[model samples]
Target: MKNEPRELLNNMFSAAVDAAQPSRCIAPFLPPPPRGRTIVIGAGKASASMASALEKIWPGELTGMVVTRYGYAVQCDRIEIVEAAHPVPDINGLRGTQTMLDLVSGLTQDDLVICLMSGGASSLLSLPLDPLTLEEKKNINRALLTSGAAISEINCVRRHLSAVKGGRLAAACHPAQLLTLLISDVPGDSAVDIASGPTVADPSTCADALNIIRRYGIAMPLAAMQILESGAGESIKPGNPSLASSDYRIITAPQIALEAAAEVAKAAGIPCHILSDRIEGEARDVGKVMAGIALQVARRNQPFKAPCILLSGGETTVSVKGDGRGGRNVEFLLSLAIALEGEDGVHAIACDTDGVDGRDEIAGAFISPNTLDRAWKSRMNPQASLDNNDGHTFFGGLGDSVICGPTLTNVNDFRAVLVLPKSADHQQEN
Candidate 1:
């Protein structure tokens, strides 16, 4: 606990990632590298790394393809690694997606489709709606990103709108034993919600997708709307018999990640309290609540005592009403900072393990007693930054943005609030 906040923050983040490491998650569940043709592949932020892990564990001449976010790709042999857009689909994603469908087109039941999927696959494995072009899908994706819809809601719409997502990917490999290993980033960790459940059966209906689109006010193109409204194409449902031969497993998830972080803190003599692995809400709103909790610990010590770190996970949403470039984590931390209002003896960190928070390069941010003071001296207004939805700029101006690039694995957000009782020495220093 005596370690510097930055060092402790990095350790906690690393520990969380290690807890959900694909290599560990992919081991026991790996089928004996199918006797017939063992095709290994998938798409998402962690897919390329998962593929690499599969190559090491499964002793077979595995060959297949996987698409990951542009900067999230890793090197692997036999299995081709394709880089594409994420949270938004693009032309490269379209090409890689076509390859997946084509790869499974002629495969026999003897062929094993080892789909290494994780968060972001829904966008990374993009294929436009039949009548709508890729550009149209892109517009809808942009709308969805800014719409502040939950991951599940956005993916519900994505599954029905795409040709490669939903259950089509698995259906294409019909008769083949499809084994999908997922690293869940969704709140509930539903198989169908992860990466739009590409290889898993989806129970979400066209109406479900349409309802979410309208709920989020995503500006669906006329073509997109007609597709959903007309029900021209549908995603896999619960009772689909084609899923009989498919296999599904959640290899890793936010729960494990949060637990691991808690363990590390406990070992370090800091009491770690887990809020929930499924926590979700408006980023700033969640931040306020977390801040309230931290204040309780700092002021009242009702829930926990001093020398404790409050931790929580799961994705949060940011409804885009402001012209800010910051991501959910920063937004959350900024809100938390504002709530604390330069309170002493409490420090915190909020970051995405995937190294990307929302669409920004910063992994997250650090908040100390002087956070506001630093922002104020820099001529940056905390409320103004928050108002503009530009948390990224606020922290960036203070040089406090924690940018780790892409760690390539996502288990959602990791928030740590360090609560310390006011000390006489600290008060004197202040």
Candidate 2:
């Protein structure tokens, strides 16, 4: 309840993360145990944690496998946990996907298959459709990521190119009652976009993938391009027979996470406003827009007045043009700092709930009224750093980078802007 902006922001972020944790959100949505075998299969940053949670509460015996990002594995007595790469496909992921498909195959109508999915599954459940090698898929993934493509567009291509995604996994589990539990990180929480909808039907076609590639100027491999061009890469459409026995439930999403953070702000006796849970754009651009909103609240106390906190959750993209470290959260904060130009009464924090931003272990960063002054004292150039996409280094140099390691769960980006009353003295250092 104190007037500590940084601590308050951090607490809010933590509340959001805690609210989406598999242990807390997965239990209520779990399906009843099947009469025959219970097989669990999944892949994502949070899949292992979901498995662990399900194992603890599931009354029936179960066995299966799930793949999670490196350093995200949780021990489960019944379900085997495999660690794999994320945002890019690797050999481990390919093999894991094949194994999962094999495990789900040959199931009976009386059996049940539980599929746990989350944000990183698109990369972690990597099994390219034949003729498109793993290396080729990896290259396409790298290109799409650096091209600043939206998550949905990137996933459209992935679904078409994957052998086990886009209802293919559900196909493998046909005849069995399949239940998919998802922790959504995508805008709108579209099931088909989460982890490319491994256990759900995909309405997108190969032509959609081709359009995204053309729109983004993404270079595709010859085989991959041919597959899309010839419609050989089309995903399972809605109402597919294989998916008839399958059902999916999104247990947690960005909106839910944002509301949890808002509750924290309310508990602290501060009015909170959630801008949107599905905001999307280039990271720096989003930051500039947020800065405009914060400035309005600080200068004129318009909209919602001062001494209030603004919360939002969503994923933003970054087109890599610089040689420095990058993360959307830090990029957003860096741009916000530049736009604010040392405006008093404005303090903000931006972090990825997964505790990893871009390729760095740092979650995100913080910015206060003195952020620019401190960077100037450290001989850092805010504009130059931002131009180079070096937000992690920029904030790290100022000792303002938020480092929380891996939170083991991800909803998406968490942004909190705390605007104190204009009359209050802004002497506190964060």
Candidate 3:
């Protein structure tokens, strides 16, 4: 029996999310109970949820704290959950960061530090480098959000500017056994790039971070400039023995999520193809490229034949130059609809697994063959919307916004394209 379209789509998307959920991946990587105390620490959108999962599975005595985005907290008896700001630093986050740092300031080789790491850790654990006030960090963060820098570039700058990031936190707990459970959100899942790799070794140099800051034309506060110039806040270097005891495990990743979706497609009698899970850049540009790929598969059959789905995952950025609300996923959908204007038998959906895209309430947008046609009918100009970087508004106007509201676990973005066979009448005649 042919599966209902929406149900099939939901199943695929659900599989993608389930594949990356913390519960399924965290337990296997857990280390044997440390001889000494087990102190759990983490930061990210998924931090609290990860903590909860650990609590459910862990049978030993464990106590610690982890910072999570405000309203994203999960209750735990042993592990304290501190709600904080994300994508921008707030005083609460600063204080929480200090608390977390203090938690590991004195640990022995026998102690265990279970680090649950994921995306958004950078902002969630906001600690301004000394001499730089929290406000200064906020301004820099604001500028970076609007700077169109890639995740790696943004993270490079953040690692240099932060106090607990770039492996310094783990270094503080020298001699302790550090087992880092990671949910890979960045394109490459580089520990140094995810949440700025708070307790992980960093290969990024001070020079690389400075270059990104300058390239983005961010005006720094006097204190920030001084900290960098003095090199007073260097991260753990590659050979630092302080982090030698730390072990890393990827609990969930985009590739794993995409494969789950592919499996669903196969089970449903639908062909599946996954584009690069590492695609990045401006949201609109990436959307255009994806649209082109979809058109090829739909019209030419040069790649996989019809009855196929394209699954992809990655974090995309938007350089916000307008006031209208923007989200990377929504922008991608708009660009895609415009590119595929009126094309038959193609439908797509793009959403952030975290359920919040660029400060917007909606996760993403959906597109059908008539998406562009409907926009025109409603007197909406697709190009104008694109020009303003207002994808959230465009999709909202059509009531097509995918609102999932903080799935409580994040694995970056998910995109799917469904292609059906073209009519024989429309087939190109030789």
lDDT per residue (tens digit) for residues 1-430 in model 3: 1676556776777788788888788888888898899999989999999999999989799999999988889889899999998778898889888998889877998899999888888898888788778888999899888889999998888888888888888888788899899988999778788888888888877777777778878777777677666776667889888888988898888899899988998998998888878889988898888889888988788687787898888888888887878888888888888988867878888888887888876778778888888888999998899889898888888888888777778888999988878756666631
Name the lDDT value of residue 396 in candidate 2. 93
TM-score of each: 0.97, 0.98, 0.96
Winner on TM-score (2 vs 3):
2
Q: lDDT per model, in order?
A: 0.85, 0.91, 0.85
lDDT of 1 by residue, 1-430 (tens): 6577667766787899888879877898887756678877689899989988888777777788999998887888788999988677888999998998888877777889888888888888878768889998888888888888888888888889888778888888888889999899888888888888877777778898888877766777889888988987588777688877898889989989988888878777788898888888899999999989988888788799887888899889998878888899999999999999877778888898888887777788888989999888889899989988898888888888888788778888899888878888766886
Candidate achieving the largest lDDT:
2
Tell how far residue 104 is off in model 1, in angstroms: 0.7
Q: Which residue ranges in model 3 land beyond 4 Å of their true spot? A: 423-430
How much is 403 displaced in model 1, in angstroms? 1.9
Listed per model in order, the count of residue pairs whose N, CA or C atoms clash below 3 Å is: 1, 0, 0
How high is the lDDT of residue 359 in model 2?
87
Q: Which stretches of candidate 1 lie over 4 Å from their true place?
A: 425-430
